[model samples]
Target: MTKAIRSPALVVRAFNVEISRIQDQTSDPQTAAFRLQFWQDILKKIFVKEQVFQNIPANPIAQELFKVSSAYSLSKRHLEKLITSRRDLLQTKLFRNLEDIEKYADDSVSSIYYLLLSVANIANVHADHAASHLGKAQGLANILRSVHVANHHKTVFLPMDILMKNKVSQEMVLRGVNTDDMKNVAFEVASRANSHLEKARNISVPKLANQIFLPAIAVDSYLKKLQKNDFNVFDKQLQQTNALLPFSLYFKRVLNKY
Candidate 1:
């Protein structure tokens, strides 16, 4: 009853886009509270108009934002907080090593999981679990895919443990080339990614995320391509999707349909 008279559907769409953009920029848990705040604010702004949102019990995200902005959902205050957070994204550390990159990756993907959970609602317990894992997996994949691009942006993606375990040096790999070192590093990362994919397959994905799973599949396909491409990390390529993927992934997901 106290909502601002906007539509929840539209709020969802706009915030979803905003969240996607942020996901592209970085995946830091430090950013979760900020992201959580963003959705909560949007929900609050529409509270006056959206009877559902207005009366909906304050979830984890809403409660946190309220501490900062008792009236934040109103006027320029809320928007300013988001803008400030967005601006901070551009200046992440110049990763001289993989350790830093992995740290950043953790933050980046965790932010995504928290934000997604805040927006999406799933009645089925299975659906809830699947979407939760899948979203985090997708975010992690995005961070991995962006390894090279993140370099250009002054960040890194792979963990040092992976680099060391595979006998790849951060310096040589970071330099990038058609060299064996880079290929080795790619193989190592891809191997790690494959593990993630196997895990993804093991868990039932939510059919509800099928529409949203475009991003998740894109991540898996990207990792698979890197594998097929002989572990080339230089090319910031999109996933070469097999047509069968959508049909199969969706069919299984329907069973867990949220």
Candidate 2:
């Protein structure tokens, strides 16, 4: 991102991170909903054109979000989707099926891309399409990556339909049981993510938007690593950071390709 958009982008991501972590930050459902509502209220204030600059929240993330929202004319719907989707997930922790997960991704992940594009002042349909697919890919990949940690908390984000189709039980996942059925579940989820990544790459986004899509490289790397391990989400190697990821991102950025 250029210096002009970098700070705003970071602010958006910061708000996302704060919202995404609300579930883990509190075990009580009401508490989580209340925290998310706090953000929703802040967003309402941020989007109010009359008092956006005058009545900024004391919270640092809200303050930055207020500035970003006002400067870029960011869509309140997109920002609200981020909060509402996470709040919905907080209430219904597990997805019913692949479609459910995709909807969640579209709301939680794709909204960030839409906001960033606004920051860059790019409004092409191709860019939005690419953002939509990449968001689903990254969102699915993130769930796969977090399976181990989520299992520790006795929480399973894997779609229940997939688990049922493979005859993998919630207890099996919670126990960290590695089995053929478990690997099959992982394979199906990873394949869906990979498919979305392919579609994202096939689309030609605006040249200026390539940097925004750099996350595609990281998503591609993770899917490849997951494949190499034979779709074993529990593989220890998957837990380690890929040392080459930074270089790969930069290389793609220089070529203006995501």
Best by TM-score: 2
Model 2 stretches with alpha carbons more than 4 Å out: 52-54
Off by over 4 Å in 1: 1-120, 165-171, 205-209, 236-258
lDDT of 1 by residue, 1-258 (tens): 012212332343344456547645555646754765666555555444433434444654443333322332333333333444344444443343443433443344433333333334424554445444554455446555666664454445566565666666656545654477567766755565456445545665454434443445556667777776777777655433467767755664554421
What are the models' TM-scores? 0.52, 0.98
TM accuracy, model 2: 0.98
**Per-residue C-alpha lDDT of model 2 across residues 210-243, encoded as one tens digit per residue:** 9998998988999999999988888999999999
- Which predicted model would earn the best lDDT? 2
What C-alpha root-mean-square deviation, in Å, does candidate 2 show against the real structure? 1.0
- Judge candidate 2 at residue 35 and give its lDDT: 91
CA shift at 122, candidate 2, in angstroms?
0.6
As a whole number from 0 to 100, the lDDT of residue 47 in candidate 1 is: 48
Clashing pairs in model 2, backbone N/Cα/C closer than 3 A: none
Q: What is the C-alpha lDDT of each candidate?
A: 0.49, 0.90
> How much does candidate 1 score in TM-score?
0.52
